[model samples]
Target: MIRWDWIGRNLPEIRELLGDHIVMALLPILLGLLIALPLGLASVRWRRLYQPTVGIMNVVYSLPSLAVFIVLIPITGLAEQATVIVPLTFYALAVLIPSVVDGIASVPTHVRQSAVAMGFGPMRRLLQVDLPIAVPVVLAGVRVATVSSISLVSVGALVGRGGLGYLFIDGWQRQFPTPIVVGIVLILLLALAADGLLVVAQRLLTPWARARSSA
Candidate 1:
């Protein structure tokens, strides 16, 4: 049985924890994007480096989040947020790099030719033509990264910073199920909300795609 009364009484705390959870899940994503963008672009431009770079990132992603967090504690200290953020960022990078490369590659050959015919340089063609077309694909990766980060942040609670995951731990130790259930539900809602927002943002950013879909 669930306790709505307990949940109602704890609404304020739940709200605060939800905010923390959002930050915990979101900050690493933003940081990872900043890092992934240039690397992804370089992978596309360099051609030969693509597979090797992606392979290395996949190796990093294979590392368990708990292990990464524990490993970072020695360097960043247990209380430092970097212990959690760094691992989540690496995970984000793994998904993003390949998506970016493929997204850019998916650009039509005729589009590239037309850009070159218009006297666009490599940089201009990439920025003006290729990246715009790649937005949907890149965003698809972002949605995955976000949901994964949200789930992984719970593991960070073990190190003292898991946002909603802390609630799960607290509930388990106290023999209470309300907080644990609430935390699970809230995390799911948060992931769905984040994903939905990304979809809306993609439509806004790529009006041409919206128009094409309507047609």
Candidate 2:
């Protein structure tokens, strides 16, 4: 059912599509992280803000991707990729904020007190002590966001920027199984690759955790 010959012949196009897919997925995550960092930090700093902030993020993230794209057409129009990226960014936020909040909360109270006793400023304590310990947990959330965004990017195809979803659309329209199969396989590969890289990065960044586990 797979047209390996077609895939073999179309390596360049497939590569381009894959590249688009990667961008579509990663851009949202980067933007989302930028927006989430401050908000997540604030939420942790002010315990009362956490509930309301997360509620809003959940509502925004719950909106269907396709519906978001459609709603943005009037403002962003269909020409720019913002129509896709914005919604995905919100989705990424929904996941990242919780991860950040939980990660920061998980840091022991003594650690905070010790940092303060050492005369570490709030910013320095947060950046030097708290953030490093939270990396593993935050990175786990990033992994989730990455995979979700990668899969969700295909939904953008309906608005004409589906990346690999283009293959799916074309395959479906032509009743050819190869392109559909190729699209599915490529997306799976992308998700796996992203997750694998995140895992490696987490281990690299948190060597203390690795040492503790090994011991």
lDDT of 1 by residue, 122-213 (tens): 98888899999999999999999999999899989899888899899999999999899999999999999999999999999899987988
Candidate 2 local lDDT, 151-173, one digit each (tens): 99998888888789889889989
Worst 10 residues of 2 by lDDT: 76-85
| Clashes by residue pair, model 2 | 157-162
CA RMSD per model (angstroms): 1.2, 1.1
Model 1 residue 51 CA deviation (Å) reads 1.9
Worst 10 residues of 1 by lDDT: 76-85
Q: lDDT for each of the candidates?
A: 0.90, 0.90
Q: Identify the runs in model 2 with alpha carbons over 4 angstroms from their true place.
A: none
